[model samples]
Target: MHHSGERGERPAIREKSRGIWRTVTWRELAEEAAALAAAASARGLQRGAHVALLGDNRPRLYAAMCAAQWLGAIVVPLYQDATADEIASSIESAKVTHVFAENQEQVDKLLEILPRCPTVRCIVYDKDRGMRHYKQPELVSYASLLQQGRQLAAEKRDFLQAEAARGTGQDSAFVFFTSGTTGPAKGVVLTHASLIDRARVAAATESLKDTDVAMAYLPPGWIGQNLFSYVQPMVVGYCVCCPESSETMLADMREMGPTYFLATPRVLEALLTQVTMRMEDTGGFNQRLYRAGMAAAHRIDAGKTVSLSDRITAAACSLLIYGPLRDVLGMSNVRVAFTAGDAAAPALVTFFRALGINLKQLYGSTETGFFVAMQRDGQVKPDTVGPVADGVELKFTEQREILVRSPGMFKEYHRDPETTAQARNADGWFHTGDAGYLGDDGHLRIIDRIKYVGALNDGTAHSPKLLENKLKFIPYIKEAVAFGDGRDMVCALIDIDMAAVGRWADKRSISYTGHADLASQDEVYELIAEGIAKVNADLAQEPALAKSQIHRFVILHGELSPDDGVLTRTGKLRRGVIAERYRALVDAMYGGAKEVRIDVEAGHADIKVRDAEIIGHRQIRSAA
Candidate 1:
């Protein structure tokens, strides 16, 4: 395969850092990567050696990844937000002998755990923040390392070429850790061929173009980032832009004007909230105009040809309303956007489509190198995850679990035969653990995880994810977790969108103390009851999940936190863990109790009361 810089002076990466947009051409990237690889080799990093990379979105981090691949060394990326203990565990498990940290804070964490991780020999740090006092003899600055590599390459040019020749399609390119659904993270070994095949398939299926630009804001440690940043770029020759920081993503996005965007449902939800909040701030005249334009856009979104008069109105609105909106959101140039980590609200999908963005859903996992299925342009559907990508064969097991066989599938979980065997059957189909079915139109509709799925005492199957997604579609509800599995009726734990709830409270002059107190207020419950009733009405229209109605619900006193073991680092809920932690609340829901008191483990002892009031409502459908 050709390297990134082989295409002359074309820009390969645009990184905004320290108030400057630094543009690096393919040739420059290739040179820097080569230098870094030589420098690493000089530091005794052999081919097959494991190197841990810890950083946020940065150009040097990307260069280090490419350099590791050039030398046939496996790159193990750790979450930048990881604590010292988590980093140490991953390092020890991967047997990482070398590390590249973005800043001194990470280097300090590595130093703190050095005594336990004997395998780590050398440390190279990028940002020079607060590292002068660090007295480690083995530590070196990234600039110094790159300089050493450049000098070494000048001295032994032929040797560097021979070292670069060591890499091949068969070599293990990356070792991605899973989301750690069970215990600690398990490494999934992916070779160059596996990643490239997946990228090729995704590019062909999506019809990705070389001119397409994708924002690389997701964590590189995740498989999604690797696919979008490393693999897809190699296959489609697209430019990947690194935002200055997480805080400046919206601003950077506006500047980059990316054609292809990928984000989680949480991110999309936040954007929708921002849009709604801004609309609330607008004057009545602007609000009416916005609403009218959106109504027209919705008609266009529904595959209906616009009338000539409506087209003229929409064109005028595009200039007056939508153009500025898209510019402000930095999505004016977006040709295709995707959301996939968790289930997204169909309204959120339709909202973007109504704004003239071709936003769609994708379904995949780390085991498949993040390439499974994508909703093609002009065929986007809100209810389904679209069709399988080219070269991927999907089937349903007897239990209705999705099974996939593709070239992108990982070889095996590192050092764990038992776990690997549990995922893949003897017939070579990888069990996705997801319950889904193929529709009459050949689209795949994922209900929920097979393990999380439960049956009612009356023998009806219940899908909590389906119910939760439906509830989250309500504007006031931020998150909802439905619990029924093995129970007679379904109950829900709801988290309110504070901004939206605050707006409602302000209009009604409902005073509250804080989030916890506001959530427990009787008025808040009434507000949420109305939202829940709307979700129930929507669910009642569906056939399968309609039976599992949300019989009861209570607003959670506080948002779920990682420390509480309720949410993962990526913000995915650990359903079993959350249910176990909130057993008292769940019990109260089914016990027909009006209220329950639970001890919250904050810094000090805090007693909180959670109350649930049932709102009797029946099926009330609204025009779609």
Candidate 2:
């Protein structure tokens, strides 16, 4: 495609920063990218050199990405929220020769690890926040680099053309690091063809249009963001909007009124919580209306096709109840809203649909270039991941592990042939490591990771993911990990939703110092006990899970965090890690100890309690 400014009249990117929407036209984007490419070449950077782009979402960052592609250079996007050590490790692993820092803080981090990353000869900064004191000879401002590129482009048009000409579909385009749930992050290399093919599939599957407005809120280093923000927009000619900051995402969403939205289940969960919390404070009239509308939603949620009478009632409800509610939540114009990265609660999915949002689930990974399966508009089923995308083949192994073969699959793990061989078989099927079965309708239902699925001593196989998902469906429980493999009974380590629990405590006038005090409080334990009992009652209805019901449980003193390696970036629980870390608590639960003294890591202090209650479920008698 020739570099045409014909699309310049249309907005390509609208970056909302500091409550201001800055629109960049397609022509302006092309010119800026060309200028950056010219400048990089002038800096003596080779065509195939690895360039690291580390920053929050910004127009300049996007420009750099396109520029790198135009020059046949590989762009490595790093998570801006990662710690300095994590950034250093990625920089060293990728052998990045040039670094692009978003602000002074990032520059400082790069400087801290500069001695380790000897390959990084140059650092280009964007925000210039705190670099005034450091007099690094290699440091250069992004603006100055763009100016130099513009100057070079003005003189050497032929050279720039030759550089841009070097780019091809076969060349390596980007490298995204996996979330590293098992070990150190692995670099999944994607060529132009790999990414572009998947983007085309996604565009066709979702029926993406030039008029669609996408909100690019997730970390750009992730494969999901790559598909939504970087690749799909280019393929479908859609406009991608970046919010100002993490805290400003909600406000930016309201202002942009995005037509296309994609977020992890955690984001949706939080939104649902916020909605419920706000509704709890509303008046009787509005609450009654909301209840009636939600009841109507529940009817549709139960797999019942809406009747004409129900549709009319629902339409009336949408106008008076759901429409204003959606507008307030900034989801009024949402044409496609996808929730992935983790499985969401069925009730949560139904809630959105009741409000007229076309929310659906999708399945993919970095190795697959992020497009594997997606639910179509009306064919969505809450219990299963939809069928495989066009041109993709999926099958289940004897072990029930889902395997995939697709055009968008990555070539190999960068510099790790042994690991690559282990992931991809000789027969061309890439082992997904996920345990799932294809339903009668051909939709895939993932239970858990195959590695995590285990059998009890009695030989009953259990899927922890399914049980955990059931537990999380309860509003009070934020996180839960069930452990019972090779044991007689399942037990759980539960993390209560602090906000919800605090509200409950406040209503009862139960005062506590913090999370630790609240968690250990007797009244709080009673509340959580009720929640766990409810979960057990629900689990008892399932044949496979009934035997795996939680026999003993304890509330965690604090929330699990990524910093502590208890939760992955995608918010999936690291069960093994948590099990090891809370060994004392686990022992106490099974060892018949009434109370246990635990050390709080935050304050480096030990907390002692006497005769703490361990909740157990009462077996329900058979109906006569």
Q: Which candidate is the best by TM-score?
A: 2
Cα lDDT for residue 400, candidate 2:
94
TM-score of 2: 0.94
Residue-wise C-alpha lDDT for candidate 1, range 538-610, written one tens digit per residue: 6666666566778888788888766566776666778878889888888888888877778775542222233
C-alpha RMSD for every candidate: 2.7, 2.7
Give the per-residue lDDT digits (tens) of candidate 2, residues 344-404: 7677788788788889898888898777888887788888778888888998889999999
Clashes of 1: 1
lDDT (Cα, 0-100) at 500 in candidate 2 = 83
Off by over 4 Å in 2: 1-4, 305-313, 602-624
